[model samples]
Target chain A: MRKRLRNDILLIGGVLLIAAAFALIFFLTRKEGAYAAVMKNGTEIARYALSAEGEYPITDGETVTNLLVIRGGKAEIAEATCPDQICVNHRAVSKAGETIVCLPQEVVIKIVAETKNAPDMVV
Target chain B: MRNKKTKKLAFLGLCTAVTLILAYVEALLPPLWAAVPGIKMGLPNIMLLFLLYRFSVKEAAAVSLVRLFAVALLFGNIMTLAYSFAGAVLSLAVMNLLKRIDRFSMVAVSIMGGIFHNLGQVLVAILVLETAEIGYYMIVLTVTGTIAGILIGLAGYLVLKYLKQKEI
Candidate 1:
């Protein structure tokens, strides 16, 4: 019984150590993003600067209305016509690599860090 | 003989029903923090863990699969079903491994199950979303899954303790 108890603690401790490591990495790498790039069907449709606060209604012309609200340097889906509304309920994201995905609508709001030094912001 | 077989089958059905109800309750709940997408308490897993300890892996898997399909059909779509099925299969496999090893406690097994379940779902999410960035959510999810796993393990442990002395 004692041996089993020790094994359990060791296993839990090991898993927590890994989780903590990832958490540390996330914390360190987290950066305020500059753009909220909206992608539809794996291709970029719209790009909004996080510095500019506005409500952008992203739609595929008719269906899939996801209101991308950029406020206070963070982006959130204020309203969504999707059934699950997982995107709407999600908290606003500001981190450079953060994303909010509405699978049903095939809309992905990705936070891209646009820096003058790094050259990836040609879009 | 036949009586014992009937008893096992009936118990399986009961287990499946209880898990299905718990799944419904979970489905009704909004996301835990409304921040993380898949951060679930995994309440239905309490029964799955109970069955894993009380009976065998086969029994637990049977109940889990039944509960998954029933819940999906009732409250979810093809997407939800896909991720859930992935989570359930991965969780059951890990839990069964821990049980076979017999070194870890129910809590440990339960925690591993929760971790693997989220891992599986994240994998499926990465595939469907076609992005590796979503893997970052697993960091937050790892902590949430541990808490949920501990709760489930405690509940399952209590149920197992009392049920151990009783006729199921």
Candidate 2:
């Protein structure tokens, strides 16, 4: 019992430290400006931008779902065929703290900022 | 003596197969929450932690090597394999070294492995990209590593318990 208590304390301390670290990252890290989309099946499926709007299609071979468009820098699963429909519930992602995951479709859309002096940018 | 040696070799082979399967399984899982391009859940580490305790260090190393190569071939992502392999090797070394300390539990060791694993991978990315700023993801990586390590450690603990009772 005493050993378990010690372990619990350690875990809690670890969690606190991680929280602090995330807080630091939240403040210290700057959002990269350029935006890019992760397309599926040659369609403009998911968009990552500060502000924009357009039609997108979600295709799974034979079937296709028309996803509603969100104009701006936010990613969301506007439509899907999966039974869960959890993807639609995902709010539009903006501010680098966002992610829209479609598990059944194996699609992950995210936004990332490129670092300054990024070799690609440097050259 | 020769027969015993053969049995040991077979056992090592089996462990290698199990590790390979686990790693490949993780690759198949949907990257739903992968907001960043390279982030992953790495569920296979669960099997790794289990092997570290159930089998010998040499056996675990064998498993890691075979798993790395097999996954690389199967996924056809040579760059990712290269980075992941570097991380896994470094993490395994750290775990083995920490295993020598009596006070460290398997779970703690696994957490250390997770932290080092991400650190090593991030370092590889930085080097490959020729950009030091990629290191800014260190905090995020550490957070994810801690969570993943703990989850895998829990799985290891459960499996170990079941094995102890079943005598498997």
Candidate 1 chain A — worst ten consecutive residues by lDDT sum? A114-123
TM-score of each: 0.92, 0.63
In angstroms, give how far residue B67 of model 2 lies from its true place: 1.4
What is the CAPRI rating of model 2's predicted complex? incorrect
lDDT of each: 0.86, 0.63
Enumerate the candidates' DockQ scores in order: 0.66, 0.08
Give the per-residue lDDT digits (tens) of candidate 1, residues B31-130. Answer: 7787778788898899989888888888898888888788778877788899999999999999999889889989989999999999999998888877
Model 1 pairs whose backbones collide: none
Candidate 1 wrongly placed segments (more than 4 Å): A115-123
- In lDDT terms, how accurate is model 2? 0.63
lDDT tens per residue, model 2, A1-123: 467547645854685487577677776774643443443422334444445455456556667643545556555667888654556766565545334545445454445464443232110
Query: At residue B153, what lDDT does model 1 achieve?
Result: 91
> How close is chain B to the truth by TM-score, in each candidate?
0.96, 0.87
